[model samples]
Target: MACMEEQRAPGHRWPYGPPWRSAPGGAEPGRSGLPWRSTLLLTLFVLVGSRFSAHGQPHRVPLDGSAHALLLLACVPLLWRYRHPVAVPFVTATAALVYLAAGYPYGPVYLAVAVGCLSAVVAGHRRAAWASVGLLWAGHALVALWLYRWLPPAGDKGADLTQEIVIATWVLAVLAVAELARVRREQWARERADRAQAARRRADEERLRIARELHDVLAHSISVINVQAGMGLALLDSDPEQARTALTTIKAASKEALGEVRQVLDTLRAPGAAPRAPAPGLDRLPELVEQAAAAGLTVAVDGEPPRLPPGTDLAAFRIVQEALTNVVRHSGSRHARVHFADGDGMLRLRIDDDGPATGAEAGGSGNGLAGMRERAVALGGTIEAGPRSDGGFRVLAVLPLHTREDE
Candidate 1:
């Protein structure tokens, strides 16, 4: 804008041109590989229109073989414009300049030069486009104001001020339009890239969500199943009735795990569909205790957990489930306790079990504690798990009472 105002200031050489802005490299090439259709149309328009232009301006030299050749020269390079953005505009501008210096009537030849410049600017070659158009305009100004007397049809006078001003205005308009187009194209490219990145982020989040769900459900249930299987195996020969009881627990655990797995898979099969059953929450604490007892870990619950939003409820349940699963799989203690508290719109749940350091050989597949932390943090909460100085491991989670959706 300041450059444009400078040109309009009195006594500034408006007949020359405006300063050009530096720009980045052009947009990527077109996939169509060739612009044969548009290039051929431009050539045809320039060739057909020159005759009418000559008739309209008799003082200008009429079109002839050399003139026709020069016009084609200007139009032909446009065939490779996208493939060679910088070179194409300069070639077209130089050809047009030579044609005009020979005093060929102004016609669609300028249209060819305009196309070349536009192509260059849109392809991310703004400086080259500006320079090329400026070269053509400067060459025209030189020939019209001075060289007109020495060349072309006899007795052509110096171009008037009005003619030079009109030519300058046209040059300015072309550059302005090209720069505007380049800016717009860059904006669209940025929008497209942003959308793609957002899509990938959403995909990653969904995959992580499914993974956490599967881990919580299977880990807790499988820990129960493993214990029951061991009990059933040992008791199958002695205490047949107790063996039957352990087998029953194993069957129940396996069935629940499969149902939850199917639910997770159903979501993948039909996205945007509601779950076939509501998600588990802290309300399922009694069931978790039953499962833990069946797994040979006695769990004592401390306080009543408040009802929570569906999302918070699910996260809370998964955190507790994972914590208890870690206790069963990683701690040697046969007893664990869950302590829950609510205040100031926050819920804190801590699971602890007495422990001697269980050897690293204790088997578990995924990072159960890490998974717990993820669930807590997703709901604007936090999780901390470490062995206490009292010779016990502890998993603690603090979740917000009001989630963003609830807020």
Candidate 2:
């Protein structure tokens, strides 16, 4: 699983892993073999220190074959420190101890130990890093005490104490820097995850809104066309003039449905395209009523429409359109009344039909009603729809004007 995750693009992950780990035969997955940077740094440290010692640096360790081999054991494994953080630090520190115990001059072996400590911490092995630091400090102190007791003094005790303090400070500084890097890496990973999740949620909401728009457009127009076609057939022989009117109504309804559908498809195809026209709002309510009346349902408006925010206006228009369409398609109603009221920052709408109850009116699929409620709720409103005790169906919606404006 770690290998598969590493195979993904670097931008999709935390930026702390070895970059070339995916190269052919580079290293085992999740293991950084010998990175070129680590190799370069270690080689430079050994070569320069060896050259300096050869130039008669009396206190430096001699570059004899055995000492060189020990140095290699301490430093070379650091190339794979990220792969085995704990083991690498222990190996390097152990080799350094052995070299010091052999009475060889203390040279650059401690550089390898410092590198191991840093790698372990940055690799998120906090326990391993602390253990390695503690072991290195203990080993150095014990070795110094042994040398002081057993060997002839080459310098004052004050100088030895200063050297030990300097070395301890350097190790602690390296650990501090590595820990800071790990914290930053974790923060970046969390922020990236949050951004990806937000993007998914936005995509889901856009899809649902588009689905509701398509349903409302298709359902209302299809219901009108169905009613007009029936009326045209009923009057084909008895009244040719009336039949021609019904056919005209069908043609108009089909044309309107096509235009609305085309607009929706065009917007989907070119999301950044300029607006072609304004969306239908409550200003078009009279036209909606006329369409229903033409379809053989008597629809009456009881009050003047109130001013609304664009979002609320569009939602209100759709709710009324859907409710009237339902009456025509399923209520068997001959007369319906649409009442509107504005009071205290709220716009109230009610559609009631005077048709006899049918099975559809009592227990229906209710997709239209569900869509209406969703629209209302999305705009901080509520909708109540059910069969009325007096005989027909009623849909009541209360939308907060101030809430829409605030949003």
Candidate 3:
């Protein structure tokens, strides 16, 4: 049964086009023996074409030993057909034609003609393939007819016609099969390229998401704490109690923010699949405020903030952080107030500081304010920041806390 299966199995595969791997910085083999495979198949045709030559024919040319040698040897370099399909086929076909013209019997050399036809097809030259097929058919028929007319074997009169038709059909069938395989290989290569491009795009998007998180969470928090610490230090001699409280706030805010940053990094670097909790939102606002107060920015809260969606909560906190940071930097006032309330289906947060407002500083365009505005806009919200005519800077942000349907 194993032997039977082996017999049924197709022969070895031939590499086409170029060798997939080769010594670097050196000349490479062109075709992957596909042309040789075709040559072997064509050698079979030679056997069939030459069978009738033994008949008592008057004009049949005896098979020349040298011509048979050329036919068998021509396939050696033709193995490079894919690497140099056009060049290899041209050389092989020219050699075969010379052999045929030199009175080499058609019997052993028909193999070379068949391989030339296949080389053209595998090279993806439809025009050349068709021409090669037509030329071989005509050559075989002309040679057979030559022998039949002069050296016709006395017993077999009509057999040559059948042999000619059979060889022609076999050549066509081989060409069709080769074309099919080439098309399939091309399709597979295209699909691989498309998948590679999609994977690159996904990687870029993932990096951008991480960047946003690092900027909004870690950078914004650090900025606010730094501002408050500076103000507390400035007043240390006049208000030692306030300075101590500011240092305490700095420590707490730093520790909490560090843990959150680490959690985000751990999830990003996880080796395999692992679930992670959603990011902290407005539910953690009290803790955020406490940390800020510890840093020496006397913070006041009023009007309960509504239960907000996850994204809105994050945006609200970022807005507050940036506003308070600006207060610590420019506001001469010692107190900052944060107010949250719900009105008209939106959650509003306002951070007000008794900061000096001049034409140069009022409605200022800074990175902190810009980042805050970007977060608000991304969530389909709006922010307003300017001098409150009463000599303080105010930042106001409004965001939808529920879906359109819920509203």
lDDT of 1 by residue, 1-407 (tens): 11112223367442222222222333223333466777898899999999888898999888899999999999999888777889999999999999999988989899999988987888777899989999998889999888988888788889887898899899999888988877876775675566566667777777888888898888888888887888999999998999999999989999999999999999877767778998888888899999998888899999989989998899888888888888888788999999999999999988899986677554577678778888888888988999999999988889999998986
Better of 1 and 2 by TM-score: 1
Per-residue lDDT tens digits for candidate 2, residues 24-63, read 2324345544566755788579756855655665553456
Rank ordering of all candidates by lDDT, starting from the highest: 1, 2, 3
Best by TM-score: 1
Let me know the TM-score candidate 1 reaches against the reference structure. Answer: 0.89
Error of 2 at 398 (Å): 2.0
Predicted structure 3: lDDT: 0.62
- Root-mean-square deviation per candidate: 9.5, 6.2, 9.8
Worst 10 residues of 2 by lDDT: 1-10
Ranking by TM-score: 1, 2, 3
Clashes of each: 3, 0, 17
